[model samples]
Target: MSEALWQPSASVELLKQRSEIISKIRHFFYQRQVMEVDTPALSQACVSDIHLHSFCTTLSGPAAPKTMPLYLQTSPEFHMKRLLAAGSGCIYQIAKAFRNEEAGRYHNPEFTMLEWYRVGYNHFALMDEMEQLLELVLGCGSCERLSYRQAFERHLGFNPLEAEHVQFMVAAKELGVADLVAKEPERDTILQLLFSLGVEPHIAQQRPCFVYHFPASQAALAKISSTDPQVAERFELYYKGIELANGFHELTDAQEQAERFANDQAYRKVNGLAEAELDQRFLAGLAAGLPACAGVALGIDRLLMLAFGQTHIQQVQSFSIERA
Candidate 1:
């Protein structure tokens, strides 16, 4: 083994800057009366999102009950929501999140996440606050905005929400990513490819842009928009084509949340992914009446990378996966 592999991935100077940035983030929330909160990094239940893979471990010892399985949280959103149900209003957390994904220029198996919820705020309001934070830390002006349909129309010359699966496939072929799209494509899957390949590169690369009102099928935890039943109240922020944050006008309906979880589990089963237990506690929190709110999870490392003009996520982390 090379001895140099043990050294930190980030320089001392970069780490110092990272600390200052974190401090600024905390202060930003503090001024807004958003309380800082903490939650355990491990849980008995993992996210049901098919796009994410959680790291799992088994407990073994005198206190363990026959090697019970535990999962490293992908984000603190679930526990934070429970706190919201318990009346912890307007809270935030800077947490360590784990995903069983490959380490890359923008990704690592473990990374920092800044997640927060604002009571009584919808997705748009949360977006306003998110942009304000970026302005404070990265010295950015007001962000650009686009709806999901507008983005597709402007760049791909079609409206994604109104397009059929076949249209998406055709777009994929034209974009030279037909093989990347599934042979028997799911509309959402094809749309994701189209956005990643065709649309994202063309949207607000010079500044932060919020693309919102996503198709209902891809809503995840967001509420279906009452104004447009075909779309959800969710939005994502991007800068320089790097996705920075995802926020939702949270779905407070316990039954609807359960159905979404079931749908995700079904997709996992069909795709041969590992099974994850449903987070009943989170659902119960919803049933107990969670406040109307919007929440977002931002990639701290990615934000810092953009702030410091670094190209790689490792440059901002004290140690990358290789060193860790």
Candidate 2:
């Protein structure tokens, strides 16, 4: 191994800048009376999202006769929501999140996440707050907003909301990703490829761009739009072609949430992925009643990258996955 592996990935100057930016973020939320919170990084239940992978460990010692499996949280959404159910209103957390995924230019197995929830606010309201924070920290001016359909239409010359599976197949072929899609042949998979490969690159790089109203099938924890059942009230922020944040209008219906979890399980089984145990505590929180709110999870490393005009995520992190 290289001796340089012992060193931090980020420079001292960059680390100082990262600290200042986080301070600014905290101040921004403090001015709005959003309470900062802390949650456990480990949980007995893991996320059911098919696209996300959680790191697992076994708990031993006198806690139980047999070792119990636990998973590192990919995000702190569930724990924060439970707090909301218990009347902890307007909360935010700058916490470490772990994902058992490949590390790349924009991804690290472990990264910092800034998550916040605003009670009685919808996704659009949350987007407004997000834009304000970006303007304050990144000084990017006002952000542009576009519906998911509009983004696809403007960039790919087709409206994704109305497109058929065959159209996506044709588009994938046209975009030179047909081989990649052939392995999955799923509509959402193809759409994601088309978005990342075809559309994301074309989004505004100098400023934040919010893409809202994603297809219902892609909704992880968001509520389905009341006016349109085909779409969910979810939004994703992208800056410099990098996904920086994801927000959702909170879904409080326990039955709907349970069904979504089951759908994830079925998809995992079909895809030969491990079936994750359901987060019954979170579901119970929903069943007991959670306040109307919208919440978002933003990548702190990616935000720092944008602020410092850096390309690789490691440039803003103290250590990359390799060094960690």
Candidate 3:
């Protein structure tokens, strides 16, 4: 088959529906007094998440023909947090986020993200706000709240936290998911696999749910629960089994954050991934003082997909990589 002869496919009506949905999202947030903000898509540093791949580029400048490395942001989280630290109140951004090595029905190398922050709020408060936002945007009446432990218990009949490494391995084997757990012995990895394969599909069938209180080790940038050190103040909203957004109570402890970033760098080295440059500027913001805040990043394209009952991401995008 000739590549030129093949044409990209998507319904015009679906595209219009996507546009309406996006408009509704902006209006909803705007009504809530959330100020929309814009930041640069290119950055001097990339995210430290070992699992995510960032696209790198070089800027050609007249100053000595310098070639400094730049990256297309995977999420606007870092930059947005910097703004929040600077006293921007209740900010939101609808922006393009880029990632490498991703392309599928629900995955794209570049897609829109609806990221927002609420100053002086914790993860639980953010969860409530996200529920209302999803209800308004999707026109759903109500949503559910489920904890990570509850999800594991409800779906797999096991307490993820209490399960030993061997026990988790046994569970995976019984579930016929042994291959997925064999290479990674970490409890979080096994739990993640089971959640994706077993629990998520079931959750998607219900109304949108905010799964909160993640294990501390998986907190990423979220603050640890003061009442329960074992978990972090984090939540992820899921719909139709699709992960729509992730939110957290900001971790203001600069020293702990620095350690986490260093640990992430070490993990990257161990995994044979490129080490990302540390954004000292962002760290300096942390040192200068960051407000107690909560932030979330929603996959805008995925939200559009659920709203329009469309399964593929490329359908909603004007020019996907294949079309481009």
Candidate 4:
């Protein structure tokens, strides 16, 4: 290994900037009367989402018959929701989150995540708050809100909501990722492919972007819009082509949450992927009734990258996995 491997990825100045930004975040939340909370990083179960690879560890103690798997959280969302269910009104956390499969320019296996929930706020209101928070953290910038369908039409000239499955196949062939087509991609997967390839790189850098109203099929923990039923009241914020945050109008129904978990497990099986155990405590919290709320998980590293005008997340992190 080279000497560079032992050094921090971030410069001293960048580290200072990161510290300052975190301070600013705390003060901002403090002024808003939002309580800062800490939750355990380890859990008995992990999310079943096929795309998320949670880091797992074995836990053994005097009360345990055998070692059982405990997963490093992908986000504080589940436990945070549990708190919300327990009447911890508005709360925020800046905590370390992990995923096993990520180590890249924009992703680190272990990174800081800034997540928060606001009771009685829908996703649209949360999107407004996201824009306001980014403005506070990154200095003022114009905010632009667009529906997911609008983004698809603007970038690729098609209505993703109304498109036939074959249309995505045609696009797949044209984009030169025919292997994706051969595997028979689902609706959301195809949209994600096209969006990541064609639109994400080209999203407006002139202003912060908040894209809302995703297809219901892609709504992880979001509530489907009762008004539309075809769309989820969710949003994602992007700045300078970098995704900063994902927010949702929280899903409260235990049965529906269980169904989504089952669907994710089924999808994992079909794709030959690992199936993680569901967080039953989290679902139980839902059954106990979570307040009508909205929550967002923001990538602190990504936001730091923007603050320092660095293109890669590593520049804002003390040490990326590559260096660690």
Candidate 5:
């Protein structure tokens, strides 16, 4: 075991840089009149995504002596949506989110997230907002927009929408991605691997790029596009090949959302993963009627890295998992 002291060298210059970036982000939101909010870190329920493993703990107290399962929220999305349903227009939050089984140059189990929602806005409008936010935070004049299909075509020499499973498998092998096809035999998994390995590396480096209109199979909680039934109204922001944010056109149908969550739970059960408790409150909020809105969750640490042109996330953060 390594017993090295894990103190980080926080130079005054770098700290000042971090502060300036944070201030700029806050000012951008303030200019838009987006109300900043806070929510609980611990929750009774957690995300149902099979790919994401949340950190769970037993809550022990006089009122809860039996030790109930509490999970560190992967994102503040659900609670924020509830607030939206309650008629809070245009909200944003910069908070610490926790996830398990993530530790790397670009990842940490515990990290900061910047999430925001715009009321009565569609996915396209949100895409524009993302561009402006990037310009404001990074102090760039303009950013580029690329659809998922276009990005795949430009970088991988194939359209992601029409690619076959065999082609994706072959590409994964060429990219040296281990266990890519074995984990999930679905085409979406293969496409994701190809994007992560092949296409993502070639995105705009100096300016942020918004990749929009993802395939329907990749839509976790977003609404499917009416114009293109094959694609969902989802977009992800990438800077210099690194994914910084994921945005979605909010899905308002409670029944359909519940069905999707059930499907995710079933997938988890089949894969021998722990089941996530359903967030009945969120479902209730949806049933009560949520406005037409779009929201996004951005990686604050990754943004910091981009702002400073840092190679690794550990450079900006006070302490990483290895150091801890």
Candidate 6:
């Protein structure tokens, strides 16, 4: 007989590891004096990024307006930053986040995100702490740090930040993914495609790698370097060719942040994507002088998959979406 739909794909032992790792994570933060925080799962404002799709629900109870739309958080970033603005120092959260997407080997619609921030830390400093966390959390050995330009030059034979049109097309042709290069796209878009198709699959073959100094266009909330204005102080962690986390030296300029949000909303509108609530509260927090900090969000389920020596995310999750 076919297995019952209510059954979980993950074994009991895997569930045990999930619990143990969560305990260890809390201890890890506790030892560092980083306070564990909790934030609302649903909110009036949501991520405005064009790439992320947030799940939404209509409120029906007395606690909220009738039929008011509440978007499930994709991450606890905005709320955490607000806390920073309120003078809360160095906080972390093991949060449940939702994103609208297809189920696959590596993805599920809802997942656990372990997010943290460090007051007065740069992206590089955060990366160092992350390496230590990996050693504790995943028993990872050794780490390699590579700048965006270095990685591109080594893998694709081009400097991503300075590549002009002709150079971009040449690199694409060299990588045998010329067709994957979108038509007349932005410079960063082409660079991103090349990174994903050419470089990413070959990264961190034996050791965790921290790729840093991304192009400013791809910074997200990261701060652009004062010395190198074209580069953003952002980094992503990879292990065994798997992207595990992303961190940034956050941008604290309120006016610049407002402009970036407006730009993202405009981009969403132009691309025919639904616009999220503008997160005015988050903007207000920025105006209130948020602390200088670096923050990261790590995928807990993916980390568990690595810890359990599993090939698919389902093998580590208690229940896949289909089972739920």
Per-model CA lDDT versus the true structure: 0.92, 0.92, 0.85, 0.88, 0.86, 0.89
What ranges in model 6 sit over 4 Å off?
Answer: 182-184
Per-residue CA lDDT of candidate 3, range 1-324, in tens?
557535554576777877787888889888989999999999998888777888998888784287888889999988988888888888999999999975998888989999999998888888888878887778876788888889888987877767777767777887788887888856777788888877888895768888889899999999999998988999998888688998899898888999999999998888787888887877888887888999999999898888778888887787677776
What does the lDDT read for residue 298 in candidate 1? Answer: 97
Residues 1-99, candidate 4, lDDT per residue (tens digit)? 897789899998879988988999999899999999999999998988888888888878875668788889999999999999999999999999998
- Higher-lDDT candidate among 2 and 4? 2
Quote model 4's TM-score: 0.95
Residues 1-324, candidate 1, lDDT per residue (tens digit)? 899988899899989999999999999999999999999999999999999999889988987968888999999999999999999999999999999998899999999999999999999999999989999889989999999999999988888988876677788888987777747557787888789989889887778999999999999999999999999999999999799999999999999999999998899899898877888999999999999999999999999999899999999999999999
Clashing pairs in 5: none
* Model 5 C-alpha lDDT per residue in residues 1-324, reported as the tens digit of each score: 555444652345776888888888889999999999999998898888888888888988996988899889999999999999999999999999998976887889988899999999998898888888777778776778889999888887777788876666667777887465756677777888788878888887777788899998888889999889889999998888688999999999999999999999988888798888888898999999889999999999898888887888878877777766
- Give the clash total for candidate 5: 0
Among all windows of 10 consecutive residues in model 6, the one with the lowest summed lDDT is 177-186
lDDT of 2 by residue, 37-128 (tens): 99999999999998899999999999956999999999999999999999998999999999998999999999999999999999999999
lDDT, residue 86, model 2: 98
| lDDT string, candidate 6, 142-245, tens digits | 68999999999998887888777887778788877677663756666787788987889888988889999999888899999999999999999888767899
Residue runs of model 1 more than 4 Å from their true location after superposition:
180-182
TM-score of candidate 6 to 2 decimals? 0.96
- Evaluate model 5: give its TM-score: 0.93
Question: Residue-pair clashes per candidate, as listed?
Answer: 0, 0, 2, 0, 0, 0
Q: Which residue pairs clash in candidate 4? A: none
Candidate 1, poorest ten consecutive residues by summed lDDT: 177-186
